[model samples]
Target: MASNYLLALYHKTLRLPFGRQIFSRMFASKAPYFKTIKPLITELRPGYCELKFKKRKAVANHIGTVHAIALCNGLEMAMGAVAEASIPKHLRWIPKGMQVEYTAKADSDIRITAEIPAEAWNIGDIAVAVNGYKADGTQVITGFITIYVSAKPKR
Candidate 1:
């Protein structure tokens, strides 16, 4: 199918240096949200990332709509990307806790964008927030993740 070809091209383009920007653009184009539920780093910049996903029946709850946890996964996806790209490579980051809230119904794919300012970042106990929105631009979920950043012992 044409969609398959496009996805393949997108994947290949993401391997380049400017791939981050390109990937971000492509993700925005498709608005793929469910496909990224497993927490994938499709695009990563200094302080931000674009997460993608696709809605599936399995992700539905008793209401037969996208589950709240599924939306939370997208939020965490954005937070994880920001955490990995923001932390110093010499240090390790571990999630400490998260506060989540569900505000609306999500019937379509969604994207979660997360970012943090450089001056606000700390090597010890970094707290970040990621907000998820539906394709129609409705806020579906919000989460605040606290991570503990520490130095690893030199081998």
Candidate 2:
């Protein structure tokens, strides 16, 4: 398979000083809503992605815990990164739906990781599992984002 341009760009940008910040800014320009969470992609590869973000007042809920929606946003971000790297360039993909469970409270910086099976490239819908954890290693949220992947229509 050919190398993914976005993944290549991420790898290249990650090596520069303050590259994470630059990458975040570029990503936010494409998806404005993702900027709200201030996510940093710590790892990205085919079938896997990991991201981290601080727990700030903006993302806090009524009781001062990370809001559920913020966690969901993080989950989606991770899933999108993995999908972009894993999917073949000849194919196209989009989020079909998401199912999530809030297992614990998030009161600290959060890390979200997502993964898909290596054989998931078969034409159809694929479910990528995403999990969020706090700094202390508690699993705070679990989710599966369904992505629809199909061969790009030929002109």
- Highest lDDT, which number? 2
1-155: candidate 2 lDDT, tens digit per residue: 22788788887888899887787668656777888999998888888988999999999999999999999999998898788878887889989999999999999999999999878887789999999999999999998999998999998
Per-candidate local distance difference test: 0.67, 0.89
All candidates: TM-score: 0.71, 0.95
Which lDDT tens digits does candidate 1 get at residues 87-127?
65567787788888888888787777777666656568876
User: Which regions of candidate 1 fall more than 4 Å away from where they truly are?
Assistant: 1-42
Clashing pairs in model 2? none
Query: Residue 4 CA error for candidate 2 (Å)?
Result: 0.9
Segments in model 2 whose C-alpha atoms lie over 4 Å from true places: none
Name the weakest run of 10 consecutive residues (lDDT summed) in model 1: 1-10
